[model samples]
Target: MNSKKTSQTEHPPGRSSTPAAWGALAVMASLLAAWIFFESLACGALHAGLTCASWMRGDQLSVGKLTYEGNGIFRANDVEFVFGTTGHRSSWKSERMEIHPLHLVGMLIRGKYQSFRLIRELKVGKSKLLVDRRGAGDGDRGEASLPWSESFMNPANFFPSSIEGGPIDVVVIGDAYRLSLSGLKLLLPDRWAGKVAFDEAQLDMGTWHGTFSHGAAVAGWDGTSLRLENLNLGKETALHEVTLALRDGRADFGIRGTIGKALIRGDGAFGSPGDPNALELTLVGENLQLGPLAELLGQDRRASGTVGQARFTFRGEPDNPLEADSSLRLVANNFRWDGRGWDSLRLAATLTGRKLTVSELSLQQEENILTGKGLVNLTRDWHEALKSPFTAAFSATLDDAGALASLAGPQFATLSGGLAMEGEVRGAENKATGYANLQGVGMKIHGLPVDWMKGNLLFEGDHVVLSHLDAWCGQDNISMEGSVQNSQPHAYKASAQIDVHNLTKRLGQLGIKTATTIGAGAVKCSWQGEGTREAHSGSFQARVTEWISKWTATGMSGSFDGSYAPGQLRLTKAEFLQDELKLSLKLNASARTLEVTDINATRGEKEAPLVQGSIALPLDAMDVWESGDVLRTIDTSGPFAINLALRGIKAEEIEELLGQKVRLTGALEGTISANGSLENPEIHGGLKIGNFVSLAGEAPADLNLTIDAAHGEFKGSLSEAIGQTPLLQMELEAPLRVVKE
Candidate 1:
């Protein structure tokens, strides 16, 4: 062969003189040598020891090291693979490789076939896996590759596939318990970072059984320079606690502990690293400790009650302070806050917000329920917070007895009637310097037994004014309007006008039995006074017109002036109860006493038989005195008579009408005393009837006779006088009683 190669080399065939057979022989010789050298390298002992290789016909070539542990089991090391380089052109590489011992055991157990496990620590290098049509014969055929494979040359196809029946489990081990991977380069669509993987990872399933301590060791992903601690996960639980620190745009984390069972999920983003300008955080968990959360925010957790199943989302931008807004909403079945005893009675307000429109707000504690709805604008400035009053029109109804009894301590029991109020408060001050306007406000004080009133009331400048106040008591209707200024704290002034028709019914409703009728009248009266708790004094006057009563006067008209100072009402005139009696009387010791004075009265006809009398009265008789038109007390001595003197009067005419001498003469003093009924009181005195004649048509003689008898007794005999024949009848007695006719 050497001599043939030399001859061919020395005389290369010229293009025109070369024979086709010689050229073919020379080419065949060169091909045989190249094939021999390639076969030697493949079969050599050193080459077999150094190179690990596997191949599939017309498809792939894999090269690595085989580790033989004296028990007939083999493992691959530092594997490199290629697929279809001459035909398909695919390739792959790995830093290390592994084969399972169970594969060899399966071969020993079942002797019919070979069994093996393939394990590998993968480290992919830069490669362009491709498919080319030029590799196929017959004018280039089609190529086939996987969907994700770059081309047919992609060496991932060189990965070992299972035999028709293979070992079930594959075990892999590496330098570390879990081989953490980094610095991987992968090309993916859409500029997304490709997934990274860990190799030969070990899992211990026993850490899921027990409870995690409050502050306990948990599992996490760890790195050389960074660590994420306490990453625990399981079916319904996760204990994945992670804290990330970033400085100057560099952030890192690594595993510090073994992973356990709870699925803890949390995400946070902070800007500016050490000096953040903004922060956003989200957390979701169950049975989270609110105390720790409040402590993280520098708040007192004990001030608020515990909550359940919290999902929190927060975003804050410290850089743009002016345009910042925040909102919070919490839902819980029940929550309570402690009131620090004596401050505000442990109150809670629902649906409070800053710059948010609230549909409803309910405040409740103990037996109180207060609800409101409107817009609220919260501000940091306290003055503005108070002054920026919300426009909330509200109606409140409260149980009067329950509300009052709550504040009244133990003084009273069970009240009735609910108090309802509707009003609007504007520009309310924090220190109570504000006023509210009340419209269509009414209150009914039920169970008050006396009167029920309904009216409009207003509150202004610390005063309460009632307008159109209509109160009804039984059948009487009383309408009143008044204002009470500063009516609280024991200092106030009130004035009202009260009108009532059929005042008798009103008095009866008030449990007063007054035998008088205050026919339709309005008592327009006002009083002003100042006093402390000890005493009160004021003056009032009322014009009483046509005040008729059965016991006193009919159609009486007068004005009564009175001054009241504490328990006394002093009346200046009691004249209307007595008609022209001209007597001063005082109501002392529940009895009427008269100051002594002259009294005159006239009754009956003015011409035929008019009666007049002047009498002195005593105060005692006026006590029980009763009369239709007048009341007076008189002293009546013997014979129930009144003494008087008369002249130029017809005694016989008065006696003829009176049936007797109506006047009596005193026996010892010769004074006339009248003793008769008030209609025709008889006039009596020592006097003689002067006989002239009847003044019918004839002139007559004028004669007079005198009588002398003691003790108002008259002795006279005038049977004949003047020119009459026997005009005087004989009077023969020691004491002659004259009966004039």
Candidate 2:
């Protein structure tokens, strides 16, 4: 065999070798060529697949045989690849084959022309890729990775348009739900010197669907960064549903909870990345629970109503810090609040930086209304915020009839008037102060009318100051100045002065009537008091120039001191009723008792012997009536002056005082007492008495007091020639009477 091999190798031309030698040479050459071709095909298939099947399970890959066409072209059919990166694991499969002309040409040329370009497109039918925790190498539980940041694979030089009729579909399984991508396109950057476009895409994850059309996105190496445009997302969940559209703005997603149901939405750019400080954006459909907001913000919704709608706007620099300006407007109807029901209510407010400003606030209940406009600054810098003072001014007007009717109690229902108030509130840190100018403060009590009052009110700490107060009611004007400490609804100590003009008119307004305007007098009074929530206690001292009108039956003036403590009122001073009567009366309001001492009265003139008396009066027996008619008409142009009847009196007294037996038919009456004292008297009946009583120098021994009576009846007087002896010291007793008949 050795000699034959040598002989066949050395043969030159037309030399036939032995059959055995020829057979051995041909077999060896065929074996070498077959090995080379098989190796090339294997290398081409591996390079095209871009996966190492040696490390994968047999079931994970379904790569078929590789084949070589003409012109250095190689193809593989029914290939599948499995891989993982960081938090992701995936598998991809295709039914058809893919061939890389570049790889085939390079292998055929044997590295000769190292820089060569080949086919620009490749495709496969029915491609599928999956990403799950089991394939991601992190066990089979917990969250894998962010879906947008997951690792994915694409063909090296395959443009999106060449990959069949449309984009390949991709499916992903995540912690929340299964995600699907449809009509996806691969994009390559200009820096990569590749021509590819990701024109349209759609993502479906649970109830959320995101679609991007007419846009392109490029994914960097390692998939760390992705740039996309013309994106839109729509979500529907249990709490709230939203649709987001973006163009020419960055997309940043920071979501927690399920895929579509997120408690917060933080997607969108903060301006350009290089100029993040100039970011401006708007957030919508952010549902904020009122109860949670109140709890988290230290705000209470305890006022007797409901809070309707609320919204906020946020704006700021992204790199340094952030701030927001927020506004909210609320509407409520028939809102019951502050002890009353309100109608037509609206409140609008805004918060800018650390300041809360109320643009318009109004409330209306029936005819009573309140309006407020103000700002509350909560900035930390004291000096800067203090310069503005967190101030507010409010004006309120109450329709007297409606307001009083709403209160309904005796103290308020009968009141009728209007009140207007304007005020400013200022504050800084822990201290707050305020000042207000008040006008048109009026009150109508028990049908008495008071008109426009002017005053200045101030508040500092817990003290309230009332200064330069001037008021008018009927014919009387009053001025007051005072300060109250620890002033609330009832707990306070106030010292004030009250002055009056035309005292009679003031009394008449209180339902007291007399004959003369000369009853006018100036009164100086001081009051100091403290009160509990239910009651008040105080002491008052008053000095009046004249207590009674001179044109009436009596004229007197005096100073009096009184104290009212809870249910009790006591008067201590010198008090006189008639010009002919003098007495020191002590009144105990709680006991309802009156004690008259040192009572003396003279009936005759000062030049003659006067008739005097000592008597006790019972205050409980007195009858007091409110005067209904303030206008007392007098015929100054007539011959005889007409006398009006006293409101609290009787007809019988008129006849006796006039020394006439007269019967009265009118409604007016004079008060009289059986005790023979004017202090406690009753109006037995109504009458108009107009007559003159003449007094003699002295009492006669018989005291023959003859009197003619008419118009009204009288009893218990001198009668029928009957008389008492020792008249100077005897009680006058008789029954000479006049009857209305």
The alpha-carbon lDDT assigned to residue 173 of candidate 1 equals 18
What lDDT tens digits, residue by residue, belong to model 1 across residues 1-741? 899999988896665555887889889998888666643443343235323232212334344554443333344444555443344344445544332223444444653543222311122333222322122222221234344433433333322321111111112111111111123232211112222222222222222122221222222211111223443332233334455544333332212221121122456555431132255555544433344444433455543333344444444443222223433333332333332111112112222334434454443433334455554455645346654445554544444334433343434333434444455443333222222222211223323233355556554544455655555545444455544444334344444444444444444444454433223232333344444446666555554444444422334333444455555445453332223212222222112222311222122222321222333222243233232112233322212335433333444434423335334221111235544433333444454444445444443443444344444344554443555544456443363233312
**How many steric clashes does model 1 contain?**
46
Give all candidates' CA lDDT scores. 0.37, 0.47
| Clash counts for the predictions, in order | 46, 20
**Clash count in backbone of candidate 2:** 20
Q: Pick out the ten consecutive residues of candidate 1 with the lowest summed lDDT.
A: 163-172
Give candidate 2's whole-model lDDT: 0.47
Q: TM-score for all predictions?
A: 0.26, 0.36
Top of the candidates by TM-score: 2
